[model samples]
Target: MSKPLNIIFAGTPDFAAQHLQALINSHHNIVAVYCPPDKPAGRGKKLTACATKQLALANNLVVEQPVNFKATEDQETLANYNADVMVVVAYGLLLPEVILNAPKLGCINVHGSLLPKWRGAAPIQRSLEAGDGQTGVTIMQMDKGLDTGDMILKATCDITPSDTSASLYEKLAALGPEALIDTLSLMATGEHTAEKQDDSLANYAAKLDKAEAELDWSLSANVLDRKVRAYIPWPVAQFTFIDEKQNPQRIRIWQATPLQLAHGKAPGTILTADKKGIVVATGDGALSLTSLQIPGKKPLSVADILNARGHWFTPNTPITGQINE
Candidate 1:
């Protein structure tokens, strides 16, 4: 085996930290760890370190938290690390050309999707929302573009119909670390080859926001089903409806299925509520919401929720936010 290469790791969040943990367990020498600066979080808005920063500190690694590389000192400090390669996973910051070239073997990335497919901030979530049959990880030679890098390794995974964003994220987390280690081994032996991505086949995955989670009942049931699954664990798909008490209420849908049975009820109408699920009318079909959550309460299955608040979801009630004309 070739000598272990000097590596610098840049990442944030739990997904990135998993890859960092893999490198720590390997033979490579991690010269430095770089992540974004701590930001205020929680109700108190107290500054909080990211997952990678916490992990790096626990391992007694040299940690650097730079807001950006525009400062000359920051750039010089990184270059002085003298690293053979830098592994970036969900780093969130755009690297300048100088920073990309500072390392001996250049910077490599553990992207969450197969290149030329879903590429950008929320690959895992976007793939689920698009209802793709399969998605995977791509270890690439990093460049200035947004995930438009030359691929060094590819690891594929199936996207089951029941898979949510959180589940898909876990799947990639498992595949990414192994792929990163393999890519580093090949790089150390000078056996890695780069494959250029076909620019025509790429799709951008824009960052997620709460606004998009508002369920538009006017859309098809299948489309709404995908959105509900993709938005799980963050800004869950929600809809507003007037409750039995005559007050507007927002309900978050955590799990749902598209029912093929046709219905004449207007979109957003509550078609039925039973042990199976809360069936709601949509523009093209019906959706059965299996798991749901009310603000200030834990998520509950449709049966459980109905047992507690059976009067709230009476059939023929119209959900708010859309006109039924």
Candidate 2:
């Protein structure tokens, strides 16, 4: 009978939890699981546990949530796990060398990009925003450099024109566990080889933030369309019309499609509103917003919103949305 490989898992968020679930389902001997400490979130600032921590506890595996594991002595505890292998997903904290070298097979990571591109903190969001043709997961042997690890396995997925961060995230999250399982199976059978990432071709997927989520009217309609999709579920794109004629209402756009207009109206212009949706003019074309959420209101289809609040917006007027200082 084949012996179960003793493993240490590190991760946070729903993405990481998926992999942990995979390991448990596979009958792998996970010695310990590491994740970020509980954080204060939401209006109450209540302390909430990370997704990984919740899973680790439920699975009866040992769990660790250190704020900063950069210290040499602090990392020694992980080295003591005597793990045969370490599998890391979107574990928020960076692992030091001591912990990396703890396992016999070193460590492996499930990164969310094809690699040599979008290789850092926010790969999924950046890929969609850049309008990339394809993106997927790269299971790599963890190295000191950030996501510059050598690839042991890779699987690609198409990025549809309508793909949003939320949709792509779930797709990639499902892939992580499946890809990790594939990598582990090959590694167990001595059929895996690591391919080094090209240093010069890499692009950093810088962390997502509210600052970048503000829709810029000056940019071409195609660009803003991607921005609206990429920023979904986090720092949603917001625009406020300055015209008193319009309600200075804030709306969170959830999805959009680009269209070329024969008439080039100024960007941010309220081109029209109909049963289909609200069409707004842009630098090069226009965007039809299908779904959106008004401030302090539930998200609704554009048609429902226009029918209820038709007076706030008029056809062929500048939207007047501004990023408030």
Candidate 3:
């Protein structure tokens, strides 16, 4: 059995919380947890604790919410922990060299991608958008450059045709803890090896933007279908259209599928509107919008939406939006 080591955990959000929870259940000692400070959220704009902070506090562990590692005092406090190692997962803040070197074994991170592929802020979503066959958790030895770390361990999971960002997030989150614990065990036993990442194959996953969620009818149905899956639970796939009253309104498409229509029509034209779905023409194929929502309303299936507002989306009506290449 591997001996327990003093560990400092740093992360934010639900993805990070799963890793922290696994550490708490392990035999190792979680000396402290570092998370982002509470930020205003929701309609009331009240300050809310991050998932990591909430889990740490519930387990009676020390929690630190430092904005960054630039301060001398903060550096001193972190060094005082005398942690054998620091484990980071989805921790939004960048670690300074001083803090990284302070830990006995240096800092390590549990990243959501396979490294050298999707290495930036939104790897999960980027992988879906790019139609990658698979993605996984990577345990890396932290370095100064962004995700340009030595790989310690990895565990892959497939990106299925039916996978949305939300579904893929859950799978990666569960895979992370198992991979992390195994890496820690290897490090403890001095059996872990570091593999350098190839910079030539690296690709940056730029953070998602609301602008990217706007559906462009000019794109192929397959591409737009992937975008809808990629942007779920964030800036969902959306399109703007002038309603029956000639008022411009935006609708978010929650679920959709691509289809090769027998007869072609102009892109953005509504081909069919029935109980099954609202089939719209695309540049190369057609898309069946199964679930959708208007502003300030709950999501509804195409059948329910047709029953409520069939007149708004009559056949031949065109959905307008800015087209991007």
lDDT (10s digit) by residue, model 3, range 143-185: 8989999999999999999999999999999999999999999
Quantify all predictions' global Cα lDDT against the true fold. Answer: 0.92, 0.84, 0.92
Model 1, span 1-325: residue lDDT tens:
6679999999999999999999999999999999999999999999999999999999999999999999999999999999999999999899999999999999999999988898888999999899899999999999999999899999999999899999999999999999999999999999899999999999999999999999888899989999999998888999876665667778899999998878998888989999799999999899999998887799999999999988778889775633446
Candidate 2 residue-wise lDDT at 210: 82
Residue 49 lDDT (model 2) = 88
2 or 3, which is superior by lDDT? 3
**lDDT score for residue 150 of model 1:** 96
lDDT of 2 by residue, 175-194 (tens): 88999988888777667899
Compute the lDDT of residue 298 as modeled in candidate 3.
Answer: 96
Steric clash pairs (candidate 1) = none
lDDT of 2 at 303: 84
Ranking by TM-score: 3, 1, 2
* Residue pairs of candidate 2 with colliding backbone atoms: 240-321, 242-320
Each prediction's total of clashing residue pairs, residues at least 3 apart in sequence or on different chains, is 0, 2, 0
The residue pairs found clashing in candidate 3 are: none
Candidate 3: regions farther than 4 A off: 321-325
Superposed Cα deviation of residue 60, candidate 3 (Å)? 0.7
- Taking every candidate in turn, the Cα RMSD to the unseen true structure, in Å, is 1.5, 2.4, 2.0
Each candidate structure's TM-score, on Cα atoms with residue i matched to residue i, is 0.96, 0.93, 0.97
